[model samples]
Target: MKNKDPKANFGIELDESIQIDGVSATATKFGESFRGIFRWQQSFFKLVWKQAIIYYIIYVSITLFYSFALDSGNQANFDAITSYLARYTSSLPVVLLLGFFTSTALNRWFSIMASMPGTNRPIALYVASLKEDAADGCARVDLYIRYVLLMWLLTFRIVCKPLRKRYPSLMSIQAAGFLRDHERLLLEKHKEQPGGSSKTFPLVVYDWLNILLRDTCQKGYFSVANDFGRNIDAIQVLKKGGGNVIKFASKNVPVALIQAVTLAIYCYGVVSVLSHQIEKHYLTSVLSGYFPLPYALPFFFYYAWLKVGRIAIDPFGSDEDDIDILNIFDCHINGAMRLRNCYGVKITIPSTDRSAFSLS
Candidate 1:
């Protein structure tokens, strides 16, 4: 069967400078975590490998030729090459071990955050709304943190354990619940505020602040919408959301196929190059020149995938899926009326012309 091109299938371009205001605090936290992961030292190894691969190949080829031409007469050269190869081979295991430990540390940190209280509630309400808003916020925060940590864990498991790939779906339920609860809470809070308050003098300044905050906060809601939308797309493509759909097809089918094929090809190239050195009895060649490609490809592919996946899911970003800021403002305005024990239902949308819009 012909393989698919992952890049073409999943490629999505995004505007780099778009601002998102109404995003949920939890979603923002996930974005921050992802950024942190990218900036880690482990992430930089990929870049190093890319630059070193070609030089490594050339070194390996030269080493093999020298060893064979010397016919075991040069014991010093042979010992030197053997020692170098051993050292190089040993480095891989060390790196892998370090990566494993680092991932464990990160997982523990995430778990601690998830288990902590009140990630969702405003700092002001923590002491008063402990049971309702505060408690719910904490649960939501925990779930959100857990969901992000689950993604990181899945990445580690796929790259390291291999056997734990079966657990990806287990985390999705909590992620979805956390996202839903976050949106609902924000919406409810927005709805409960007054349309206008006596805290401001001219009333115009208060109206503008309400509008600005509403717009800014809606970015959080948009993030939730994008997350849900992407999952839905993935589900459609996989046919079964939880399983490994090796044969699945959809709008994203081309992208998935392409990615798999590219990865296979990259793997094949590295193996082919390495096998050539092995057959020629060129141990030094394998150690010196061909070592970096195997390490580089995975890292490059991962980074590319992250950028493309984000683009695919959030093309319009905060502008498209964002919460209705104006609607929230209207809700807050209407709700504030209840505070004064006024049973009137006539909430007005302030106009540019003061005489035109008035609430009795």
Candidate 2:
């Protein structure tokens, strides 16, 4: 995150050049909310006001131009025409369209959030259902759980920008104890091979888990038929969740729908403000002369809602308003480690053919 204070800043402030003023908090820390409308750093104000400024300027200019040019009688006639237009144009259809579009965008956001695996629940189940009490059995089970946790984190790392930032590269991931050095080297090697497009890393983790499960079953860890089936089912649940995340991440909200919504909002904003200005010219003329900021309130609200909906439609980006993906992964990792450590199990990869599972 970048600081907004001029004293802490080195470069020219673009907003200053534009003559758009804002009250920036010099000492506001991460996760602190600057939420109220009075605070210039509020998301609604920051996102909405910049665009609203343009329309406001247009409204004031138009009002002033008319006020000076028109006589009292002609001004009344012009107001009548605009009032008539307002009656037809400022109807409920615009609101209905905005409502539907915003609802759809919100649904898309929740859908992506819901697609993530409930890793803690599945992890608790795995820990509770461990049939083997022996040291080697516990270690193998811990290793498998660690792989599952790693796979989930890797899935998020690919789709979520915040997690990608935290684990910038394979080396960072290796340093974080999620990937062994050999594993990172192997992934890097696969990445260097250049004939075809690279496969996503989560799928590689998925394949490795499947191989681990089969091998462990063969080695008599999950010896009982019911236990093996149940364990496999748990793994499948995790795999399905990961698949859902990947599917959603690869796809995007329909562009046509987004454009339609955006077009409607801005166009309606223009129409609504224009109509209001003409219909209430006498009141607006006075306000424009005495206090210009009051004229911008309705538009500020309208633009803010539209801007909020647009931001909500895609919540996986690196913006401050986005979903906290890095913290979620950190929680999952901590939970997995705690569960494994409680059973005194060491979670190291076995020295088998580890080269085959490559994330690169």
Candidate 3:
């Protein structure tokens, strides 16, 4: 048998990004925690290895510069500066800031993911309202589902760089079957309006979706339209979630806090190596200045921790650590398209009594 794409199990197509799912699905034993430690995709090592290498290179260059380049007089001044930095670095609260920021980012990221609007609710609403839909209802269902998904893409395109890659322009999305040609002409007209459109054209898609939905609903084609309030609720959730993502990523993370933490980590590393220069003084400790092991630990920890926060804030980005937005889109496309394919109700059960049936 041919090997299947792992994501197909989730009813999604190949996302062409990273896949971290199913790595530990069967690792139920206590010792199995390490099952995915070495996997290149979505590994912590994968996320931070490039930065780690650059850090070590810079640290080593600074170390060599200190040990060999400086004259005795300049070396003494350098030592003084490093000592001063090392002394005050203790007050920076690097750990506290990192811990708080990372925890908060992680919590918000989870919320964004949970609140990501999926078509499941809309699909359920369709099923509830029109189990035996008319032909016109089916056409409306097709249009409604497409519009819902288009709205998601429109909003996500505001924040998600990857989705923009898939649908670079609203015209591209339209050509790909997401919008009607008339809708395309309407968007174009909107784009040419007073003051010219925003550099980002997709922002108008929200307004378009709003107008499209209102007009479509006005015809009263839906048999039982009350359930559609549920779809509206889902759209509200999507917009709110998108707004949170934008606000948290761009505005929530305090710039000063980040700068302080970054300076602390880098400054600590450079000063730490110089301060512990055992070769210059009488050395006793096995791990001294030349042995970067001491500084390496904290540097790696803080740097990697900060990167986790960076990836957490923009979960829709191109990074391997980003959440799979395409999966949700696929669920909408493949599953929601079957909204009008419902069959007659099947309520039959076995006629045999439970007591009469043999356990064997």
Ranking by lDDT: 2, 3, 1
Q: Clashing residue pairs, candidate 2?
A: none
Q: Assess every candidate by TM-score.
A: 0.23, 0.70, 0.74
lDDT of 2 at 287: 70
Lowest lDDT 10-mer window, candidate 1? 242-251
The model with the greatest lDDT is: 2
For candidate 3, lDDT tens digit of each residue in 1-360? Answer: 011222333333333333456476566798666777767776667766786677667666766786679888887887777677667656666788788788977887877765555555654564555434444665656666676666666667767777788778867887778877887777678778885453334455555545645554576534556645655565566556656655555555566766776776666555554455435553532345445676667767777888898788778877766776655566456555554354334567979987898865
Query: Which scores greater on lDDT, model 2 or model 3?
Result: 2
Give the 10-residue window scoring lowest on summed lDDT in candidate 2: 1-10
Note the clash tally of each candidate. 26, 0, 0
lDDT of 2: 0.63
Each prediction's whole-model lDDT (CA): 0.33, 0.63, 0.63
**Candidate 3, pairs of clashing residues:** none
